[model samples]
Target: MSSFGAIMVSFPGAAHRQFGKQIYTTLIPFGVMERFLMVDDDVQRKLNKRRVKSIANYILMGIKDGNLCFLSAITATCRGPIQYNEATNQLSIDISTQMSVNDGQHRFAGVKMALDTMRRKVDTSQGQQRLEYSEKLKKLEDMAIPVVIFGNLTKVMEQQLFHDLNLLANKPTKSVSLKFDNSDLYNAMAKELKNENEWLIRFGIETERTSLSERNRELMVLSTLRNMISFIISGTDKDSNAVLTLENYNTWKTDVSELIDKLFSVLPEDCNDRSRYIIGLAATIQGIGKYINYLINKENLSDEKLSGLKKVDWKHTNPHWNGAGGTFDPVKERIVFGGTGGGVNGIYMKLIEINGPSI
Candidate 1:
């Protein structure tokens, strides 16, 4: 039995001292875990509800019968140190001691919510549905998560531990992260497009997960494609808080892919080089994504307008782009004048204007 300040809570687990710290490990059940945990806001930031809800959705809606999921061990501590009996492999906390979480707060909250939701489903459901939900509830109740507990520490020590846990970790680059994450719908779509589209191959696709180098051969990166699809879905180049969706993912996929194909077709053979055409630049593709969204979402895009790209002069020599978004530099092989923010907006407007009459 557990909850902060409850009667003595005991469980079979193990503990050992590491670098002057006593650490404990255990597999905790969801029902017991929900009541067993607490948090000190002073040591951790306020919970992000959106993040918690995202995790909850993964738990409830994840595509599987067994609902296979994984979470790293939660890091935590008791208000007072826990005692362990090596012979029995039993761990116990004294009365009034509290189990507080230092990390994995979001996962903890999500699991608790999923457990509560399943219980409600079982209670309210009728007949076969109730039986089905009860089965699910049993499985959920049986779910156990690995947890790591630090020996009792003061508030200052907790703050330091939290800081080290968050700040010391290095995150993977955006491109690589998206490439490896098949769970995200957008990333999955991007991978499928990359393999199926020949246009991506001819111009080259960047898989190294870095910005294109001066002599780089790639026209676009995986992350860029993933973001482009997101932009197209949201129909905005600016940051948007609204959720994005596509009526049929393929319809927009074909439209945007055709738009890109046509735009690239109009350019000269030398257009693949970033130095030869501002259109070859990554920022230009970003702008194109916004424009494509605008065309579909605002202008009621048609076949003729897409085909009209054959008429636009996309060369860097075009005066429309010179002062508006900086100039092309042959020596550096990069944009010379306009910076990133100003440059993206410039390219976006230029795209609309370049195809204005026909559009």
Candidate 2:
């Protein structure tokens, strides 16, 4: 869309939400929304050859409203504070850690998306000239948006910024466990898990983990989806039976449905995309498993206590084992516990007490 009369558009939601409406309602028919492409970094990367087919299939099957993408600079800034200057048509962002130009590509994409939607024209002819102009635009992208992040932020200020971004993104905090209690095991596990935050974002929404009402639920859904996806993408023909046999378009739909009915049913009604919720729950549950195993393998839990444990309910285990041991008990969902081992030490029978009126 080419325009001499410059108009800037900014919003609190994704650029698609803003521009989609504008293009459909005002720009497209008028033929104003044309020159610039409104692309998110995340969207572009996932559009590659391999993912393209699956992504197309997913969209066609209505499996995902939005797919995972490369982390964008605009999204990366959620940890910091943001200020939008409507008057000057700028966004100012500040972070404790200075991000490089390459790292800021996604943020630049956000601006590009905005400019595209607003029908701003950039001179695209010169190689060096284009870089120079974009460099200047990059500065505007950074200065116009204000974001500040540090370990030393005041609790209240940090919380305020955190919440503002969460509400803006419509994030749910139902996935992270142990956030509220801050239990010793949870703290240790969370610290370790954060180390893998980058890789974890591939199948999960790392940015919005803390905003859920039940972080465990979010974690559960994510972990399961990742595992399921990996199983499909990396397996031998037999192992990846789901993807190999089903038409590509049906794969995501069936898998997502099963995942939702199994994992995220614990959540209350009203959440969008039950599939995303399932993915989050799976991630949280896997996190619990990773952490619990960390404790178990580290010998953090005493041998006696570990031995005394006959069964564990993964479902009841926070952040992990939501399927507990993955066994169905007909009436009960899933149960986990120790089975009999070769005994000279003898077997420990752990009795769990359940409450119900006697029939």
Candidate 3:
């Protein structure tokens, strides 16, 4: 009992492939995965709490709806020896020593957390609801993901494997991700607003780029619009429920489109070029979002509140933004806009101050 004896934990695969000299591919159940995964702290970096939470939430959402969630295979290495029965296509790993997971610790942790959450929920439910939850729990417990196991690797080898696994992998741009995602209603509604409204169509929105270039004619990026819409609708910066109803989508689209039109009406109209004014800057967009979020409950937009839009110096090189939206790089000969940080907040605070009580 003190030490886990040499009894092997068997991982059965439908079929197995050996890659290079020692890598073996296999499948592992969620049940067995939680117990055996050990992170070698010396070789791996610390687990990210946010990433773990996001993964857990995604799995839980899929499980609740009885849908399949997709993820890449997790990597693990044999500490000493791996018993491979070629005839049975099974991998036997010993639990006597610490066999560390070289990659995907956050994913493992997320799955574990999701299971724990279901267990807790199952304990509290009643009758048919309880039965449904129990079934979901069982389904989750039985689910398996492919695992890539390596013949005993040294610390250096594990480190190198980690590097190789993540080296060239790149996440898509935020705008592109929002454009393709059908999960959240906010992104969909934002896209709808852009497509339906004539003003927005003329203003131009970047569907792929993260930031607009100085010479770029587009005012806002799709991802930035998604974020602003998320804030406006949910009053926070988190993904809302996956609401796919056409009615709700249309309703929100109209309301948001009207609000955006109200903003353009208030700001100075640049006829020749939409990008000539500061109104379309990402920071300004977010600032306007924050201001509009405060007016969400109001039925009417009075002339008094929007008077500040006219007071603002809407030029691209206005001196007011020197240390506010961004600092001026004298030698670089350009204004460096702050990114996803204090710049947006600075603009919001200035808006609130200037838009105060119809002065």
Candidate 4:
């Protein structure tokens, strides 16, 4: 039932042998060929509505803005060998043949759904709105979906390809992603601090990944450092549009580095001992960083007054943390930190109480 004559185009390098041989493929428009793409009834992965809706929204936004581009191609394998005309350099695909999408089925479905939605909108609009929606619908129809078609692939080969593509794919962790992020001023500042601070390097900051190894001595994740730096510079855990400029970023970066250096210099000798002090914990560090911001902003504390934070006892054994939603386990010798919001607030209130009335 699908019309492939207008949409099909000869695409080279769709299939490559391990030893080095090139096979041909056909690139088709989703608008024309999506109905022909089939999934076997035995496939265990059911379509998730949440995922489909999310991806469909993303696709809709991209199509509206005219910036949707897929960097990776989708792949599908034929149940039987495809007819190829070597003399004409064309691959003949039969619409009746069972074509199993090996990967990107979700994306394909989302895009199809998004296109259908746009078509419906176009049908209901009037005048200028109708014209605009019509344009969008046309663009969606013409959108090229790159597909790598594999022919004569056995069931085992199809399963292996799917496993290799999805299961074996390596994605960078949050810390590594944040470390290399240049757009966010907080991430940039954290990376700079990691490079410049001898204390951070000595304490072993985790830059390459989020999770700490069992034997790893890293005291902070890069994402944690990012939040800390953001709070220290802007009195908030969010990037401020006011400090987005290069001049403001540099100034804030310098101030943050200086404040962090001073803060670390006065920390107790056991600051890095996770069992003794919450300072080593990421959530606790974020809470402390926020409290510091509060002191600098709300309490109008000078650098000298801020430095007086060293006088406060930050150990887990400090009675200031007892009761009032705070719990400590004597057996583990560690404060049982509450959930993120409650724990941060608890730490903040405790610090505020100890610091005592702005001097």
Candidate 5:
């Protein structure tokens, strides 16, 4: 059994020690982290930030004691940021919505306190724990913090530590930037695939008793493809170089199919073919990659390479549509973007209507 789980509760400060132990021991085995949602009133909000952080400290303290907790956010939607009160030695939330949400508010406040507690207790020789706060925030004019949660906590924790230690660090807002250079995108895509494969292999080895491994592996691959495609299309106008122009979009479309084929071949045959097909179309539109590097390398690249690129030649493989005696091409048969037909090569993929769960 994997030791990961999450739970919600009405009480914010209860069962902290035991809860922490369970998180480290039981939940870790199950690959779970229990998330507690507690309701606090305005009075609780006004308390010293340390008091708020104590709740997190107490829970994490339990996890530390039990040796069961390792902070991670692979399965949750969470954000973290630090808000500072210049006048008081307090840090308030920059985004108060998290504070409004019962669970999020406490989680944020508790995380800060946990770091503070750990930092103050540090002995140079005992260095089992590291101090994370720094003094950089004192120089900034804007004291507000961006909202962070779950996986993002890793960064937030570091940022808070930088602040606590009176060290200057990168702003929390800057750390979350997803801008990709053309080459960086390809490296990211490759790394993403490698990570997915590792997850697949682990799931296979760890869940031998059940067939859940194959399903999980497929889902991860599919998700990576979806994310990669979106990353490519996102902010193309602002961040893209001259290479990603509409003239070459068609070839990019074909490359997307090739990329999907490569991704699918890496998966176990147990995966559904329908997912494979949809993923191919999605990848052409949203992949984050460095094909532009190749274009730059090939200075002689001419119109011949891009001529047939805009065409979506794939036959529709949807069993449901075929069963109904309908033949609708899932490709550039429809208009997209500002183009009236075939979406001016694969530019249609960028059109808002090409909807799928991947988005």
Candidate 6:
């Protein structure tokens, strides 16, 4: 019979022992533990490919020799153990028995896939390279993932645990995460901009997940501003290479801050008047940011040359926006910035048109 070995410590919390219950916890290696941790089809959430890939990338990037990334313990309900020794605090988990993962199924999947990928890479390498890859694969396989084994749980209890783990926890919104993420250059810049600009703070720029509710609010969401800054600096929203390296942070920061200040100063006093101007719309702002990036990178336009943006007719009612796939709806008195790629391209082209032959 196949078995997995673990050094079990008495589970924490008095509540675990109150009902004449004894619980044990163990940190198991990925290679050995992956077999037993089964994803229950009925209880588990549907797997998201994007999320799994992102997690796997994080693990690959973060984990190194003599350094390890921390992942929260995986909670699971186990069938009764095959055997345990009171003296040694060692436990044997039978491979034949059933175990259902109550939480961290995505994490489990990501780790397993990452290990497999490493193994495949190792297998394909040759000579010294093979040895290096093998070492990394071994390290990943031996990575200890803490697992809390709750024994003698009924089906109902398992279901309840699953529900509690997935549903009860409050997940932070993207805006909140971006606002608090000091590590990201764009996020840090957004925070700095908020602090530097009294007008933005006064307009009640939302740092949280919630959107601007009042019509009078001049600024968009904090995350939106972060994206705008990212586009302005990088020329593209997701271009990592365009970002300022640590060596030139101060220089880049000064440049970006100055550009942002100039851009904001020229905008109309009623920036939130979406009915009259496209500048009030979030999509329009993003489009204009991208266009500004193009002018900086492609045209090499100075701040003085950029002053021409103030002359453009930004109103949605302007005939310049009237085309086959127009963004403005005169009847509703609003600009309909569509979410599709075509819609975005249309807005970008319209901005380019307004900038004229010199742009």
Q: How many clashing pairs per prediction, in order?
A: 0, 64, 0, 0, 51, 0
- Order of the predicted models by lDDT, top scorer first: 1, 3, 4, 6, 5, 2
Model 1 segments more than 4 A misplaced: 1-14, 63-69, 85-96, 109-144, 208-210, 233-263, 267-270, 297-303, 322-346
RMSD of 2: 19.3
Off by over 4 Å in 4: 1-7, 17-73, 77-102, 105-147, 151-164, 167-173, 176-185, 208-217, 233-248, 322-326, 338-342, 356-359
Cα lDDT tens digits for candidate 2, 157-215: 43443455545664335334333322222232233343344333322344334333342
* Tens digit of per-residue lDDT, candidate 3, span 167-225: 75787898888888765667777787788787778877789888776677666898778
Estimate every model's Cα lDDT from 0 to 1.
0.72, 0.31, 0.71, 0.70, 0.31, 0.69
Residue-level lDDT of model 1, residues 29-100, one tens digit each, is 876786678877988889998888878767775424533356678888788757688888978877556678
- Give candidate 6's root-mean-square deviation (CA, Å): 4.9
For candidate 3, what is the TM-score? 0.80
**Number of the predicted model whose TM-score against the real structure is largest:** 3
For residue 233, model 3's alpha carbon misses the true position, in angstroms, by 1.9
Q: Per-candidate TM vs. native? A: 0.75, 0.20, 0.80, 0.62, 0.21, 0.75
* Model 1 / residue 342 / CA error / Å: 6.7
**Could you tell me how far off, in angstroms, the CA of residue 356 lies in candidate 2 after the best superposition?**
43
Error of 4 at 93 (Å): 6.2
| Model 6 pairs in collision | none
Error of 4 at 262 (Å): 2.8
